[model samples]
Target: MSINFHEVKKKREEFWNSSLVYKAIHDRLVKQGYHLIGTIGAVKRCHWTKEAVVRKRFCYKCLWYGIESHRCIQMTPVAAWCWNRCLHCWRIQPEDVGMHWDDTRPPVIDDPEVLVEESIRVHREIMAGYKGNPSADQLMVEEALKPKHAAISLTGEPLLYPRLSELIEEYHKRGLTTFLVTHGTRPDVLKSLVKEPSQLYISIESWDKESYEYFNRPLVPRAWELFQETLELIPSFKSPTVFRFTIVKGYNDNEKALESFSRFVEKAQPTYIEVKAYMFLGGSRGRLEHSNMPSHDDIRNVGRILSEKTGYKLLSESIPSRIVLLSRIDKPIRHGKGCPDGVEHPEKYAPAFSKEYEELTD
Candidate 1:
């Protein structure tokens, strides 16, 4: 069924206020140490934003923060409506089917400028206490309050946003780097995005077409073909690419699937591969049992299998969440060839912060 953007928008607005799906997402973000800054925070943290403080706070605190403050900012494009309803998804509901631009409704501001202004206001209010916290360093606290980077995979398929390319371009102009994640459901939309992100991620949930359909429940008519097309296009792009595999226990966890996935990755030749376990949350609870969540040891074993088969080496593992990052040993080049130093050169590309922030109303 084709999606009706306006009708779906209204339903999504209702869902935002009443659905468990919204609560699940809010809870998950909080647990992951992310503050829902929305659009208001986006304006205040204009130049020296710490985007990572909200989306990847757990990672920032443990790995990137003080040890490598230079790499601290990271943010997600807080929006909704994904192209697929995978059984393993932790943040959405099973009933949430099909694609619709209106997935994130009530909170939606008219334009990017208004959104940024509101973001600054909301962010300041939320982080007011950190201003005087003795344990927090002045610099760190300040950085944490700003929004530096953006991850365009907060909820919905960001590519579906009518002005996604413009939004991305705006972020680049502000000196913020972009990390875009797509489900490979819309090759046309993926190809149309104007800006080149620092890193691009394609979620290849299953090995075979049948498994993909069974697992992802994609809305697009030609989902499999689009997935293949997306893989084929990855090599042509200069940006670093990642193939993320969300491993679910008793599903796509065997050696055959691993071998298939490795072969596909070889074709794509991405810079990094992230293998993560499926957490039992949201609609997945009704479809899958808690036992479906694999243990960290299980993830390690699977990572080893893929590493050996694909000639990739394991760089790190998050034991608690059963996630692993594998890098191609021979491919020494980082995700963004020019971004090796972790510094964003806006003159070379787009600015990271939005220029609209300058005109935001109080």
Candidate 2:
């Protein structure tokens, strides 16, 4: 439980500036294994990052792209702010704990360089537990200590961080690839980024305005329009773009939804499309039913339909994650230092400790 308290005064200032909301949110997030860095940034060890070293199992990112799961840091610059309270998102939302604040921005903006450096420090501290595990490979654990990829989609709309472009640049300067995921609520932030991530992911959960409001529960006005603006902006990015669909069974997986999704794909023209099943974990368990979780076959079926609709061929499937990859090109674009040789592919194994390690940090 070694957390990065970069400046206690800054932490106090953040709490004072935002009333008690910040403290309440901070304690809860800390209990969830998120090490708060500076006033706003945080780093939480990914489940796959641990399993990669201890069990030789990697996440779908490793199979799809070449990210070595063990050598990746799952983090966020603004952990408590987001526009959308999507029903399927696994992270806890403000309202879930009977707390609400301005989700539009953070109470305090931390330095991006300090965020990157301290996040990596916390990442290594979190990995220390895995090093002593009997099943851990010492060599892999050593590599895990030196993270090479930053998954900046941990628990918030990272675009709200204000200095996100600088954060991405800091990570890149340290030789780490970044995968930034956003809810498409901030087209302005996307456009403003001078340093783009290695891969950009937009979480597109619904097809139309009605469904968007229904599932996303976005706080801002005209959220659908903002989303459309982001879709249009995706094609302008020089780096690879991804449209990620977290399919909730009997919700967005219907025929009509598929048609609308195809239309969105046409607009964005992202390098890849990921159709993944909505995971019934974390705060989502309180919002959605376990029955909403789709089967791997369900995901594959949807992938087939989208492939036909968008002409993005079904390139691969990671059955354990219930995710199918649709690509306009022949193969996935690898990023960062890839998984080492002879690593076990996730497709052959069951989902990586979904329940057993759901509570682990770092």
On lDDT, the leading prediction is: 2
Q: Encode model 2's per-residue lDDT on 234-258: one tens digit a residue.
A: 9899999999988999899899999
TM-score of every prediction relative to native: 0.69, 0.91
| Deviation in Å, model 2, residue 292 alpha carbon | 0.7
TM-score of 1: 0.69
Off by over 4 Å in 2: 1-18, 337-362
User: Which stretches of candidate 1 lie above 4 Å from their native place?
Assistant: 1-78, 94-110, 113-125, 133-138, 329-362
The Cα error of candidate 2 at residue 39, in Å, is: 1.0
lDDT of 2: 0.82
Candidate 2, residue 167: lDDT:
92
- How many clashes in each candidate? 28, 1
